[model samples]
Structure formats: structure tokens, C-alpha cells
Target: MSTTFWIILAGAIATYLTRVGGHLVISRFENIHPRVEAGLNAVPAAVLTTLVAPAVLGAGPAEWAALVVTALVSLRGGLMSMFLAGAAVLIIARQFVG
Candidate 1:
């Protein structure tokens, strides 16, 4: 195999092992404390914020407007709705602003 193939194979194996290891470790815990459970529940949101913050901070007015629309729509709708609303707003805003 080429070096690229070997690198991809190694990455796949590493990703699989980490996923399985996390599942195994988590499954062993019979009863999680309330605080720990709450923290775990917040992890997804925290991760999403961390991933999005930098882009949002560096974005232009149109992007910021889209984000505002996204937040408003998110309050009254599900994830898909929020995403669509944000995308539509961004597209429209970009046409006018950019």
C-alpha cells in the first residue's frame, strides 16, 4: 500500500478503538451521579459552542444576521428547521450585503 493508504488505515483504526474504548468505559459505570449526568448532558452544547464561536466571531454582518435568525428560529423549532432557517437567511443576506 502507498503511504497515504497506510495513513488512512491507521486513522480509521485509531478512531474505531477510541469509540469502542469510550463505550466500554462508560458502560462499566452502573450509576452515574446527578452532577456527572448533567455535565455529560451539557457536553454536546459545549462542544458545539466551541466549534462555532470562532467562525461566528470572525464573520461579517450577513453571517451575524443569519446567526440571529437561527437563534430566533431555534427557539420555536427543531434542529432541521433552525438549520434551514439559518441557511436561507444567510443566502438572502449575502445577496444583498455581499
Candidate 2:
């Protein structure tokens, strides 16, 4: 096999072994700390918020204006209204800016 093929195969095997080994080792633990468990439970929500917050808020003035409009629309109308606001803002921005 080529060197690249061997490297990829090794990486895949290593990842599989690490994941399986982790599960095996974790199963042996009798008790998980309550704080750690709580933190773990919160991790997914935190990650999702981190992922989405930036996309919703990160931008220049035009983007911020659109986000504001969307938020207002969302509060008054619904998701579709919010989407329409964002799309309308983007179209308006493109027309004016570029």
C-alpha cells in the first residue's frame, strides 16, 4: 500500500481504539462526580449556544441591523417573519453596498 494509505489506516485504527478504550475504561468507574456530571450535561448546550450566538450576532453594521430587524420580527410575528426580515435586509444591503 502507499504511504498515504498506511497513514490514513493507522489514524482510523487509532481513533477507533481510543474511543473504544475510553468507553471500556469509563465503564469501570463506579461513580462519577456530581459536578462533573452536571458540567458534562451542560457541555452540549454550551457548545450549541457558542456555535449559534456568533452566527446570529457576528457581523458589521449591516448585519447587526438585519439581526435587529429579525429579532423584532421574531418577537412580533414568528420564525418566518424573522427569516423574511433577514433575507430582506441582506438583499437591501447587497443592493446598496455592492
Candidate 3:
């Protein structure tokens, strides 16, 4: 409706295209290199660690608790599940622990 809204919408579209574009290009390959597949599989854990490191550096008890739960969940779950579990723990703990 506004200039800012249009900018945000355009950014969202561009981001989505960029994210999918990589997969589209990669999917054309009949066989992926093992090293490439390993690198791709590592991306999620690498992303998680980078996101966690800064927060953990200056975090309190609630944040630490959530991070621990997230790490534990990560061993058995996907990124979204671990994130949601961590968020829920953080929110609930913050209400009391913080």
C-alpha cells in the first residue's frame, strides 16, 4: 500500500527467488559430488552454531536453558523444531527466571 510496503514485498520476493534458485540449479545435476552433499548437509548445523554463538556469549539463565534444550532437540529433530522448542523454553523461562 505504501513505498515501504512495496520495498519489503520486493525484498521478500527477491529473497525467496534467491533461496530457491540455488536448489533449482543444483537439482539439474544427475549426481552430486560427495563433498558437495556433505557441505550442503553441514549448512544447517553451521547456521545454527553461528546464530547461537553471539546469543550465548552474553546470555543469562533463561537463554542458556533454551540453548541447551535446543541443542538436545537438534540431535533428534529438524532446525524448525529445535528453534521452536528453544523459543518456547526461552519465553516460559523468561517469565519466571528473568
Candidate 4:
């Protein structure tokens, strides 16, 4: 009924359709070329960099410290561990550094 509900519903439908379309297209392909495979593999990293670059570039000292801690934890741990490590570092930095 509300505009926000419609917008959310449309976004969900678009996301679902995009995912299904991608799977359908991939399934039809018998074999992927090496170059295409490499490109596909690089997509996640590229998207992650695009998402994080702005925040890392513009953030305050606390956020910068959190990013460093998160990167270090990510090297040896899973996503949850990395997230917790980053959050903890941010909290500590905010309290003591700010």
C-alpha cells in the first residue's frame, strides 16, 4: 500500500529475477571459457573494492583502525570473526581515540 513497501517489493523481485536469470544462462552453457571464468571470479573482489573504497578513503581514525583490524582478521578467520574483530576495534578506538 505504501510507497516504501512497493519499492522494497520491486527490489526483491528484481534481485530474484537477476539471480534466476544468471543461473539459467550459466546452466545453458556447456563449458565456460577460461577468460570468462577468470572475469567471473574477479567480479566479487571488484565489487567489494568498489563498496569499501569510499568508506576507507573518507572515514575517521576509528573507522580506519577498524578497517585495518578487519583486514588482519579476515586473513586468518571467517566472515563472522572478521566482522566481530572490526566492530571491537571500532568500539575501542571510538572510546579511547575520540
RMSD of candidates 1 onward, in order = 2.5, 5.9, 3.8, 1.6
Alpha carbon RMSD to native, model 4: 1.6
| Cα displacement (Å) at residue 21, model 1 | 2.7
List the candidates ranked by TM-score, beginning with the highest. Answer: 4, 1, 3, 2
Give the per-residue lDDT digits (tens) of candidate 1, residues 1-98.
Answer: 89999999999999999879867978999888899889989988998999999999899999999999999998999999999999999999999999
Global lDDT scores for all candidate models: 0.93, 0.81, 0.94, 0.94
Report the lDDT of model 2 for residue 7. 98
Candidate 2 clash pair list:
none
Q: Residue 54 deviation, candidate 1, in Å? A: 0.6
Backbone clashes in model 1, listed as residue pairs: none
For model 3, where is the 10-residue window of minimal lDDT? 47-56
Candidate 4 lDDT, 1-98, residue by residue in tens:
99999999999999999889878989999999999999989999998899999978889999999999999999999999999999999999999878
How do the residues 1-98 of candidate 2 rate in per-residue lDDT, one tens digit apiece?
A: 89999999999999899779857976989988899788878977898789768776656666777878887888789878789988899779867765
Best by TM-score: 4
Provide the global lDDT of candidate 1 against the true structure.
0.93
Q: What is the lDDT of residue 68 in candidate 4?
A: 93
